[model samples]
Target: MSILRLPARQQVRVLLLSSLVMLAACGEKPQQAGGEMKVPVSVVTVEPTPTEVFVELPGRVEAIKEAEIRARVNGIVQEINFEQGSDVKSGQLLFTIDPAPYIAQRDQAAAQLKNAEADIRSARLFADRYAKLIKANAVSRQEYDNAVAQAGQAEAAVAAAKAALQSANINLGYTRVESPIDGRIGRSMVTEGALVSAASATQMATVQQLDRVYVDIPRSVNQLAQLRRAMAEGVLTRSAEGDALAYVLLEDGAEYEHPGKLLFSGVSVDPGTGQVSLRAEFENPDQILLPGMYVRVRLQQGMDEKALLVPQQAIQRTSDGLNSVYVVREGKVQPVAVSVGPQIKGSFLVYKGLNPGDVVVVEGFQKIRPGAAVQPIPWKQAGAKPGSQPGGPAGAQPEPEATPKG
Candidate 1:
């Protein structure tokens, strides 16, 4: 029946029902369109690539050569020769001790030697005369033998006097304290007129060579074992010569200008710490590296031929210490658990739970959910050059990774 021909009350009721149906239809159409719309996200395609494997560890700086200047003889310090905190050469006079007593002893030894020489000459002349007389039967054989014995005793006295003189001279030389090495000397321990003794071996000063330095890093035994196993299993390949390069970060968070090389790995493990010592030599011509300074060292040990990596931003860390990333599969997002190794550049080295040709979400994380449709786009990092790869060598991290914590 036509609404116009119905009763007034019924017509009003029919019009209200029609209005409600039209409004419901309008809402349903928009809801269906929203479900069909896909969220746009930046992603990266995973591919196997070669990359250097390194570990960053805490290390201490040490001088390449160090020497303690000590008193070698007992004497009063007469003068301080070298300036405090100044460079010194080998054999350079650093301090002068009281030399008067040593000088008198040397003179006494010289005079005794001279007297002994005179006695030896006179005794030898008498022995020569007695030998001739005995041959001519003018002197008794016993008398000639006594004369030869006296000459031999005089010669022995002369030799003893000469040795005494040499000893005195050596003691005199010790009065002038000199540097044993070429290095920078620290403050003097004793001032002028201060008594120093050889018996106690009093330390006078310190000298250290700063042109080069050694960085000592300790690695846990477990880490060393893992690294060895990786190499043995062909998971990581070392350089042809088995050599490695080392770089350091200063305390101020600046990278050291010069690079260093591995010196040696200690064979014995430290009983107290359960760690092995590793030393690397670095050129410190500017003397920027001081002994006892703490630093972070990046040691490149091996290469990963077919390594998988993901963007640092893409990895999500949970409160339980688990790491995961969003991966797009068949135009849908899925959460995947991954085992991450040390961070390299701006990406993390993936050890597990990722495969080649996988698309990983790098941006628009908040808009994504499990099984949600997504429109993946190539991820472009801020400040990155054109055509640069995301989370690749084109980007860098502010700090090096501490491998132990990873």
Candidate 2:
């Protein structure tokens, strides 16, 4: 602690302190060139857009008109004219019962009718002769009365014979079995030789009209209240189109070509599932779509007048389920949270946290940190177009975790 020392060690300490002070004064400045973080990124323009929103529901294909074809008379099946599972017109003959028994009954009735006519002719002659005899007083009154009684009995016999013939005709008409409606018939339940009755215990076969088919979908009852509230606020509207358009996706990942129409909505909610039934109708000319086929329907819900769109690559969900995006401005990265809407065209409808003029960072995000300096490149020319495709739909899958080329 000596201030002024004549010793050699004291002078060496003073020279060392002076050298340290001079070096500190000449040192590098704060915020030097190497301190800045650099990141290469792709930028995309955020535009306010008006887009369509769709609600997806699971549904199964169904038939609009279905029925069980049955026999109306008791007889053995003599012939079957219609093919199994083939389309048939109304009143088309499907099956024919044996008409032999009915024919015999009809013939017997006709024979009795002819016999009655012959008896009438003889009775008429007798009655006419009696009348003449009575007028001339040539025959006894008792004989004339007997002839009149016989003639009246013959007339009653003729009427009874006519009634029998009419009943026979009706039975003969029942032998022909016809289709009640135009539809596609299922396989024949009874073979050519099987006997059927008007009152059979089991159904013969089923027929369904498939050209105009129905589809039933189930949705939670909670959606009803949500829809009503939306309508009151003018956020939604009851579809004016009688046939609200619906698109169907098949099991094989292909979409059904023609759109369907919403037909009816069930009033009663299901107690078990707390779901309501929604019915729709479609035209199936090719008969390719069948009942019970699992499908996804895209129901057009409503449209948004002003919306924001963002590509899929630009948004990422954090571990805590918060949606975050990295935006680029003046070669700097900023993380922002956004609210997303329905997914469409491999992109999302951004409802909040973005504006029309902001540039969003799409690529090189994993390597950069918040507030890091970045080399921002326009998305279109930086690389391949983002959100322009699905993830390898038909072809072989691209290698995962591979480094993308610059």
Candidate 3:
């Protein structure tokens, strides 16, 4: 019965089977259709972030509160009050010179002052008697005038003695050398019994305040011009108050925990170095930042009024060694070569070849090819902080390494 069902095609099937066997013998797999292909990938979406763009240059660290402790009065060092390299507060005594001589001078002034007071008392009594006698005609006018003049001279002498006493007290206080700043003190230049002078060029000890420090950075004119141009051209956004943002980085690959302000920029350019001096201040509550520690500083060109940005991983170098990013469009991957200028937040400021709403592939970039379709997801959903994170693992990842970006 089955044979009868296949009867119409039995002869035709026999001839076709003979041809297929011959083709199989020629060594080829049969032509197939309805193939299933799937690619496993993590995808990220692109979004715009208005962040300040800046360049980082290597900088030298400095202390805002630094002082060299020197003696104000010439004397022998009688006491060393502080240990070397220890922290000291402002006005704290660090060295006590031989104060016996100052104390003797103070005592002599005190003795002189008492004598002046006794003389003034005697002269005042005589002057009062003479005034009464002069009116009663009991004493000659010249004698009465002489008594009054003696009282005036005694009063003047007392005033001069008091002034001398004050001066002596000040000199006595100066015998103790004190620190003018709160900071770590260096090794003492003069030990106990060593003679020091008020006019010594070398200091008795050096104290540098590290609690608050300054990092002096040199900014090039070309770099400043680039930033200014970006702001004027509306490439950089303005903050709510319209000021640009700033960031700092320390040596050993650490980003400063706090954001800094651009304190001031030198109006004059250095002819020798061809750079302008830029200064920024930071609070060092823990006193961790030391003076003379080299660091790096970054300054925003300006806020990109409505800047467009994308994940840095989305960018790639093409075979031609040009910057590029892969974007998804019409259910296919399209390679886009962009002119990326700088990074803002966790993304980059694309100068050309990309727009705000474009779907750029941030994840699975290595496996993606031209014309390949991808799934798009929100970038922030992966936990990216604008300008701070770039090419890092998505979602609460640590900030990317910012190495003096220009």
Candidate 4:
């Protein structure tokens, strides 16, 4: 069987046959050589659960009550009684105006009142005498009438003096400016020796009640209308009487420890922004919240009893902006279109196109194609090590295996 012993044509034919056999072997598919192709993937079985929906809106902190301290009388500021940025009580004296002029005016009014009282006593005695003399005809009728008229005029002057005295006393009391509310006071706008007057109404300081604070949040009018429509359609549920709960996120991204209650939602939209205003009340005993500070408010709008949730990573958006998810159906990969709602934590609320008990691939979707057979594995979080199984022991059944497919 030596090629050298054979003829040239036979040698050429043998070489050609050998080359054809090697090419045929190389052309065979790898899967056919061993077994059917199966892509390994992680999946989660969909389930319906009660979920709470929250709307986050930008808000600003405001004082529950704000009072502007102003001078009520014309006088020079003699002293500032309270330290700048200190807490003050209601009716506590905050400033003292020079009381010299007011005191002099009050004394003058008192003296006038005393003189009027002396005149009143004299007039009463004269009127009594005139009445008796006229009855007895001891004095002429014209003389008696003139005496009675003088007494009445004196009485009228006394009444006017009394009113002037009261006015003076009131002005004297206004010299001491007091806090109208119990709150933290700001810096003094006018220092000692500065002139303040009632006519101009000079601002002395500002006080704001800070034990409880208000958070004013502006929400889009369109968004609010959509939420109402959803509620009417029975897609959302809320308590008819009680206010919704709220939580605050500070500017630095830290959440406040205490929760708040929504006070009210505005009925009218703002003309400038077309937004509805919402207010929440929070306990700020520590003064952690200050007026005009910006914050984010998380308001619980409503609850959905039957909500479908999926991991955010499992959702894929195509070039056309259509959202979709890949699911394993009948041991093969399948693509499904889904309508997603607001994001809840790390998951999204699935609104449409997906049913409970469907196995959706959360990982390894890139390795599988439509209609391709896939070996579905339990989906582990990103924190888990590669090849490690989720859930408990190896004997534990996966969620998809335990749940009855719809």
TM-score winner? 1
Model 1 lDDT tens row, 1-406 = 7889999999999999999999998778443434556999999988987777777888999999999988888999999999898889999999999999999999999999999999999999999999999999999999999999999999999999999999999999999989888888999999998999999998999999888999999988888877877788777888654678888988787789988999989999999999999999999989999889999998876877777888789999867878889999988999998877777777887877889889999999888779999999998878988765544422223222223211
Could you give candidate 3's per-residue lDDT for residues 1-406 as a string of tens digits? 4444576679678778988999988997678886434333444554555455565666676888789888888889999999898999999999898999889999999888889999999999999999999899999999999999999999998998898898889889988889888899989998899988878643799999877678788877776776666566666545564543345676565677766676888899999988999877778877667788777666645454454566667778888878888877876778887877655445666677876677777777666678865655544535546534243211112212322122
* TM-score between candidate 3 and the true structure: 0.66
Q: Is candidate 1 or candidate 4 better by TM-score?
A: 1
Q: Residue 112 CA error for candidate 1 (Å)?
A: 2.4
Cα RMSD, each candidate: 4.9, 8.6, 10.2, 7.4
What lDDT would each prediction earn against the true structure? 0.86, 0.74, 0.72, 0.82
On the 0 to 100 scale, the lDDT of residue 292 in model 2 is 71
lDDT (Cα, 0-100) at 41 in candidate 1:
98
Tell me how far candidate 2 lies from the true structure as C-alpha RMSD in angstroms.
Answer: 8.6
Per-residue lDDT value at 165 in model 3: 90
Ranking by lDDT: 1, 4, 2, 3
- On lDDT, who's better, 2 or 3? 2
TM-score of each: 0.84, 0.67, 0.66, 0.80
For candidate 2, what is the TM-score? 0.67
Model 1 gets an lDDT of 0.86
Clashing pairs in 2: none
